[model samples]
Target: MRKTIALLAAAVMATPAAAQPTPGVRMPPEIGAAYGRLGKAMMAHDAAGVRSVWAEDFVVNSPNNEVLGREQVIAVMEQDFLDYKGFRKHITYVGQKPEVTVIMGYDTMVPIKGPGAGKQVMRPFTDVWAKRSQGWQLIARQATIAEAR
Candidate 1:
């Protein structure tokens, strides 16, 4: 019994605390899947794919301090200004309501274009999504650079 207890404790200690889901924060599988598609679209720079995930009036308060519309963001992606070789979103908070769902997370990426090129950067982000006629679409976002290496 002692050996079994010690092994269990060791396993728990070895686990990353941040990897644990936040209490009372449950994300619907549909929203999680949509986020996955968005990441893939962004990485591929597929304008149509991106549009599918973003609402027509989608806007973002960019880290550059500019409020950009969906078209503007697409333009940036086309220009390779937002190109990234690696991207990971670490969702820490999730709030779901009848009309909308809000998620707060940090994204770590290695940019291959624009500022901080060829370096790993961590940005804290908030994404607001709504269930539209088609499906869940991102309506707003705010991303801020927290660290760069």
Candidate 2:
């Protein structure tokens, strides 16, 4: 009995952390859906679709270290300066309130334009979202490049 228990404990301990589900982190389905839309819009370079997900007063501290407003980011997308060949967001943290939610994560993407073109880049990001009559809209964001290869 002791030998069997010891082997079971060893097996569990040897499991990779990524194979385990994160505890106490419950991402609302609505937010997940919103992120899905954002990623799709970005990958397709659909400026209008991206605009609908952002608040009118949205702002972001970009990886370029510039604070940009909604229109500026949209313009970049419109110009195809923000084109991405592939994109994926990995949510690591979520802070939820009655009317707002803040999510932090890292995005991995291969941009087809801009400085990191043709390179896989990882950027850590934080996004603030507000619940409005229309739906959830992204109000603010901060993103910085963490790696590129």
Candidate 1 lDDT over 8-121, as tens digits, reads: 211111011122245676877778777777766766677898899889998887654567688867765665454555566677898898879998877676766455667787
Model 2 regions more than 4 Å off: 1-24
Clashing pairs in 1: none
Worst 10 residues of 2 by lDDT: 8-17
User: TM-scores of all models?
Assistant: 0.80, 0.79
Give the Cα error of residue 148 in candidate 1, in Å: 0.7
lDDT of each: 0.66, 0.63
Using TM-score as the measure, the top candidate is 1
Residue 29 displacement in candidate 1 (angstroms): 1.0
lDDT at residue 130 of model 2 (Cα atoms): 97
